[model samples]
Target: MIGLVLAAGAGRRLRPYTDTLPKALVPIDAETTVLDLTLANYAEVGITEVAIVVGYAAETVASRVKGFEERYGVHLELVHNDKAETWNNAYSLWCARDLLTNGVMLANGDTVHPASVQHTLLDARGDGRQIVLALDTVKKLADEEMKVIWSESAGIERITKLMDPASATGEYIGVTLIEPTAAADLTDALRVTWERDPHLYYEDGYQVLVDKGFRIDVAPIGTVDWVEIDNHDDLDRAREIVCPS
Candidate 1:
């Protein structure tokens, strides 16, 4: 299995830094970036080959590929998303459909978390499950977070940001383990989701999978210090998590 990162979205909320680089390249510390940590996590888990889906400020990521590979001791393959600025991540993920057939530990580029999150997902990769998501059951759910619903009988029933916070089981922390068996269904769902609405998130594709009777399991990452860097406030939280003052 390989590692996959979706780093296409243009984080307009994070200007200046995102002006020259993608959100993934935003510095979590003095020298390391969000993407750097992600690659290190993959390397730690014995995944030497990684595919990154790049869009907005694609050149910036392209320029750093070699350096990142050397630093992490892993090979990096960048997949370009032509519609990153105009379309949502459902399409960004669909852009790497071919690579998904190899099985992948997928993470959102903007999220900053330790390697333990990936370890949690990798450890839970059996039981005939196709897609296993890293869920934050310990975090307080908000309307803006990508929330999920799960039952004992039926894995994850729903995943969306619009759902009522009170009804959600937990927040999906942008980490997922997708088995090779899930590639076709997930890619098809992604295509359907983006074609139906260009603005839909990839979580909508997961919803499509759920509607089609596909089982998506969840692995809880308990009380982790992680942050999805969106605005300046989130960047501060990420800095504090990785390098406290």
Candidate 2:
């Protein structure tokens, strides 16, 4: 399986920085960025071939491609999402549909997490769980968080941003292992989501797969610190969780 990162969206909430660079390029530490941490984690887990979907300020990430590979010791291939600024990540993910065939350890470029979370999903895949998700069951959910409810059997039966935070079992941490067999379905579902509405998130793709009878299991990274950088407040939290200086 290959590693994938969706680093497209123009994070308007995080302005100034995103004005010149994508959110993934915004530094959490002095020099290290969210994308840096993500590539490091992927490399740490022995995932060398990585695909990054880029759009807004895509040039910035393109310029750093060789540097990122040299530093992380991983081969990076960039996938362009032309609609990144006009549409949500459902399309950004669909843009990588051609590159993500051999299964993928997909992560949102805006999230900061250690290698352990990557290990958790990889381990689950190793155990034969085809569709795997890295969940943060320990963290308290907010309305904006992508929330998930427990399945009757196992994993997540439903995941969405519109779910009531009170009923959510946990947050879908934006890390997923889509095995090769499931990749086709995921691609199809992503297309449906984007065609139906350009504003839908990629998580809606998972929901479509569920409606078509796919089982997605979860691997909870219990209490381990991770942050999804959104606004200025989330950036501060990311610095605290990752840099900790």
Model number with the top lDDT = 1
- Backbone clash tally (model 1): 0
For all candidates in order, the CA lDDT equals 0.94, 0.90
Q: Write the per-residue lDDT of candidate 2 for residues 44-73, one digit (tens) a residue.
A: 999999999999999999999999999999
- For model 2 the local lDDT of residue 118 reads 93
Q: Candidate 2: lDDT of 87?
A: 98
Provide TM-scores for the models: 0.99, 0.97
Give candidate 1's TM-score.
0.99
Runs of candidate 2 exceeding 4 Å displacement: 126-128, 152-154
